[model samples]
Target chain A: MIEDKKTKILIVEDEMIINKMYAEELRSQGFLVLTATNGGEGLELALREKPDLILLDILMPIMDGLTMMSKLREKDLYGKNVPIILLTNLSASEEKIMSAITKNEPAYYLIKSDWDLSQIVEKIKERLSRKV
Target chain B: MRSQIQKKNFEEDLTNARIAAQNVLEDLDIEKTKVEKERAKEVAILLSIGDGLVVTDENGNIMLINKVAEKLLGRKKEEVMGKVFSDAILGIEDKEGKVISLEKRPMNLALTAGTATVNSIYYYVRKNKTRFPVAITVTPIVFEGKVIGAVEVFRDITHEREIDEEKSEFISLASHQLKTPPTAVKLLTERLLSGKMGTLTEKQKEYLNDIRFSNQRMIDLTNALLNVSRIELGAFTIQVQKKNACAIVQSVLDELEPITKGEQPKLKTIFPEQNIMLMLDEPLFRMIITNLVTNAIHYTASEGEIVVECKTINKGETVGGKLLKENYFVVVISDTGYGIPQVQQNKVFTKFFRADNAREKHVNGTGLGLYIAKSIMDHSGGLIWFMSRENKGSVFYAAIPMTGMRTKVGT
Candidate 1:
């Protein structure tokens, strides 16, 4: 078990239940967490708050998670180093996008529909801590 | 003196005999000429009585025209008889808008080039812009080693073609409208079943899952309907993007985990070191995998092995294995379950058609899964086909093309 207060993370997911579950799970794992329901708020929080890591969803209604991630990265919002993982139900589609993003070496990808909720926090931390 | 007298008489007799003989021969020749004229008139009447007729010489100059040809061409014999065959008749275009030409028209490449020619759905157009849809045949008339003239015969066929097109258009429209209802239901039920909206009991959840299943079945139906329409109208759309075949297969396996949950079936997936990447629409392609794999699980017995095989083949013209193209990755799903009957194998990709034994075992499907999978693969320039046999097993293969499926094949 790790110590408390590791890093702050922001979750950008459209579904309220998923967003809540992810936030609580990350917080319980000793990380500060923030969240946004849509891509616009997620972009704002990801830039202004500048969370240590980001978990994005691909198929959101207004301003999808990918669009938010791009906009933030375009402005160089992550201080050129913040890790971002795209968590999505559309894993196949989002994986291609992530592979392109990972060319710049973004965090990683996890399929939400396939992943157990319990594994999210640990996987995110493990991916962020890795040196590629 | 007697010899002289006999010679004079003979001379007189010869002149008279010669004159009489000359007159008799002239009278007989005139009667024969009259009889020949009558026979020629009867032949001309028979030729003119045809549906339509035109005669052109070896050089394709119009030489003779019957009454039907005169009316059909919107001209009298004097006006049209000397015109070249090109100016004599017009062209006919089929439904796809191909100009179907008559087989023996001299200007037609098929005839003049000495190639075996094609007969077209002919439409005769007059100088006045009047048209007659007719079945026309052209016979090259040869006289003494030379094509002296050609005969064109024709009749009308507009009503038949119009009826066929109307029937096809109606079904296409009806199928399109039928598609929207099931799609709407799918989205709505997915919202309810995903726990996105509210909480539900286990039984309620089961009912909702059933609804989802039934709704999905309808979507399959709607897809088959739309597919038929698209093929007929040649309006099918394919949107291919860079995709990972491994991830797609994983998601499908996950989605159908519910089917194998109680059965305790061991699913072994052989994923590659590098992702199997290709170009395809994710949702549409997912449908192909989901249908095939789910059907595999449905037929297999409990504790049976479902081996998901994935491999990437280098791009080239070599087609060796199932759905394996030279330049793409193929995902093959093999099940050690019930195999398809031999008699029912040929009808696999047919719409709304399923095997009798399959229906008895796994009774729920639109029988359009293989058809749609085949359709998607065909659109993407990929391949999808299967191998099966009774009491053996079945392997459903789906190939994904890497290059953009830029080539569009029509219906």
Candidate 2:
């Protein structure tokens, strides 16, 4: 395994336990993981850090994921090119909401309960590998 | 001379009395004509109204059956006149297809109670056995403080039921969306406890297992709710693609293998030698198969034997006189389990209906599985039915058209 020091990822989640668990798992997989508890904090750090990828949650305390996505679209590093995978607990039963979110074509929409940590890590690696 | 004078007075008085009697008789004739005209107007109004109208005497004998009532009940006026109200209208069934009792009939209630009865709904079956939903009102015709007859008016409400179904579907969808967080928690704990991330202590594993189990329950609840909404909304769009039916069932069985691992029931499968190919939606097909198989497993005892057989039948082949047209692909799941009681058999697919035995044995089921499965099959243009006997066993049959031909049947 090659240690790619420059490969950085940003995780924006409101739930403390889930955010910490995801961050720890990503770090173990040899990627630099930066985290924010809400979308507002996530947006500032994402602009400043210019990470290679973003894991965004839909619902948050200060600002939600969709709004943060629109704001990030304005920036240079966090532009449309950087893949943003939605990591959320929101059910995809609502077809309207799902279609709206998928319009921007996020890298993936992974329901939290449907996958394990290992599966998410594998997905991340596959996406990053494709980018490289 | 005195006798002659008395006779003359008597003759004059008699002539005056005759003229007064003629005037009284003319007034009586005018009043009679007025009464007849009012009665004719009432009859005309009943005949011209849109709603089906039926008038029954105090004894519940059919008095006047309007054209609409005759058409709705699929009976002729001549055949129904003078017949008992219940006997003449033999086509009325309840929502469950049970014949409504005579005492419960609206006209009988109005006549017996001597008061107006209004605003009730029931299914009205026609002579040809076709059924439609209807709303009815029965009013007693009271005259001079005596109950004379009762008039019943009913209107078809098929469209109203459809609207109501739509409203419930929206509510179900919203509830389904709310279960996402619990589902996420369950998945996370399951992964950690499975040791995929790292090794865990025995105590830690036990706690995580508890968490996973609770979360899984939440997941199942949400899934059932979502499926119900999808079925009611008629949201199942057939995205037909060629799929191997046997392979799809095998995958579903594999997923369920873990649940049956510890006290597993003896399982058997008989699939066709060639993969049964059909144009269908893979996910929905998987759901129908999974629901039936899961029910069989859950209801069966530890030592019970479960058998699943899949095969194809040629067009026009009939099972018990029910014709199966086109090429039919069928799956039968049978289990030696605590079967459904005979009395509750008709209500198996009804929402929130758990068999008495099933409820006593397994407390985890939400009772929405069969409902969602039936709905899915209906929308997919397939058929699902079952036969069961208490303490014996159950056999569930699911059939779908293998060709482009399909039947859109729903309960």
Candidate 3:
């Protein structure tokens, strides 16, 4: 299992700087990276590419991450079953996120302001391993 | 200025006076003098208002300047008595020492066109040559079909205006600063977590996840502040058009879907008609509904059912007031969420107001959401209110007037 091929990850983010930073960091973990600028395009690509894991930004133009996630869930097609993590800097409503994690149970809920690169990679590994 | 009716009546009186004079038996002499004196006293009473009062003649020369105007404009009644009203009244400048809207000056048009309009004429300059802010209303006084003079009533608003502006600036600066650090932390964390530096231990990953969660909340607060200020300045306008109510609800839910997860509340909407064409502001209505939904979600227990209903109703019947001429088209959002105490319901509309209980629970509220929501409804010619009990949950309603139904109630 440890010697298995690296998982593919798709990051849907609005900000250019953050998207690049996320892609760069994930790639260094030996994971293949895909990027999209908005939730609409992200959904289109996710449906087509079928990435193993998804890292989505909540605040994005052209259909935000949350809406895209629901659409993917409702259809249960393409990359619909992939483990997804919500990336945001918003600090209030931890319970909302926690409950969401427990239910959709994203591999890990990452708050951008507090988590470091090392921590996020660990989450990706942990989530990938804890399959249903 | 005299209304057309008043001018017509005065002309009629003049004709009667000529007829009475020919008889030489009527008491027109004493009655005529009495009427003029009474009118003068009435004008004097109007002049005595705390606001600056100035009366200008046909040529814009200052016919009268009250005490308040004397102090505010740095000119005495004698000094400004015969001066041009345009120069004296228009002399007032804004806080930045530049003239505010020239068209905002009511006296300018009133003096020329015999039109009465209330405007914020500036008497902002202080007695010591410093600038203070004053809001003035100018109305022309006409008699016998001619504008004899114009009266300007003005008030000093130096302190209030300054404070309001200062508060706005502070909020803007603070929110901007608050957002920067969070963005930076979020950026760097994403870098480290994605393993740019090196592989992370399982425990290290858990800790980072925690850090990320807390940071998410900080961002939400900053965003809330941005919304609060936008609403306060009365600029949170909406796109008004005929739209399907169901479409808006679906979008909001879709927007909130990720958070809805397992505890996904049973959300129901009664859109009796598919093309019911809601004549309202979409973006603004979106904000209002989104905020209330979020509040309900936060307060309600997991898996609770929430009902959102829309129906047109007549409001005046229950309000029992002559003021409410017509009923309103309304939408009601009811939640099986934690209910608010009865005592605090009345205060929900106040700016930045939060219930003590809600605060105790550490609810991250700007307290401005409901206030802004109420104000939005108010200015939109609609009404927003809520009914709740200790454990019975809450029902929040918004009633928007249809078409021309929402006339400006009163000034």
Going through the candidates in order, state the TM-score of chain A alone for each one. Answer: 0.83, 0.88, 0.85
**Residue A109 of candidate 3: its Cα lDDT?**
59
DockQ of each: 0.04, 0.20, 0.16
**Better model by DockQ: candidate 1 vs candidate 3:** 3
Question: What is the per-residue lDDT of model 1 for residues B1-411, given as tens digits with 9 covering 90 to 100?
Answer: 999999999999999999999888888789788888887896587566667666666566677678877777677877766777654455454434455555544334322543322244456566676566666666666567555556666655567656755775676667545644554454455556657557988999999889877877765565556555554444455556777768877878888887768865578889864476666667667878887887788788776888888876666544334433366667778888888999888888877788887788778766777777777676667788788878778988777666644434243
> Which ranges in model 3 have alpha carbons more than 4 Å from their true place?
A1-132, B1-50, B53-65, B70-153, B190-205, B233-243, B278-282, B314-329, B404-411
Candidate 1 lDDT over A8-96, as tens digits, reads 78889777766766776576667888988889888888778888788887767789876776677678835356777887543232234
lDDT value, candidate 3, whole model: 0.71
Model 3 reaches what TM-score against the true structure?
0.52
Chain A only: give the TM-score of model 1. 0.83
| Native contacts retained by candidate 3 | 0.36
Q: Taking the tens digit of each residue's C-alpha lDDT, what string does model 3 give over A1-132?
A: 343666788999887777787788777668889999999999988888888889988768889877778777766655456889888654323344545556564435566644666677788888888885
Could you give the fnat of all candidates in order? 0.00, 0.29, 0.36
Q: Is candidate 1 or candidate 3 better by TM-score?
A: 3
lDDT of 3 by residue, B1-411 (tens): 569889999999998988888666456667777889998998789678887788889777887888877877777777677888767444666434666555545776786787777544254655566776566677888899888778888787768766875786577557755875677667666666767578999999888888776787787677667666655543344446777655776688778777666765677777665444566667667778787777777667776878777665665554312234465556677888768878888888887788876776446677867776776776677777777876668888866666621322110
* Share of native interface contacts present in candidate 2: 0.29
Candidate lDDT scores, in order, read 0.68, 0.79, 0.71
Stretch of 10 with least lDDT, candidate 3 chain B: B402-411
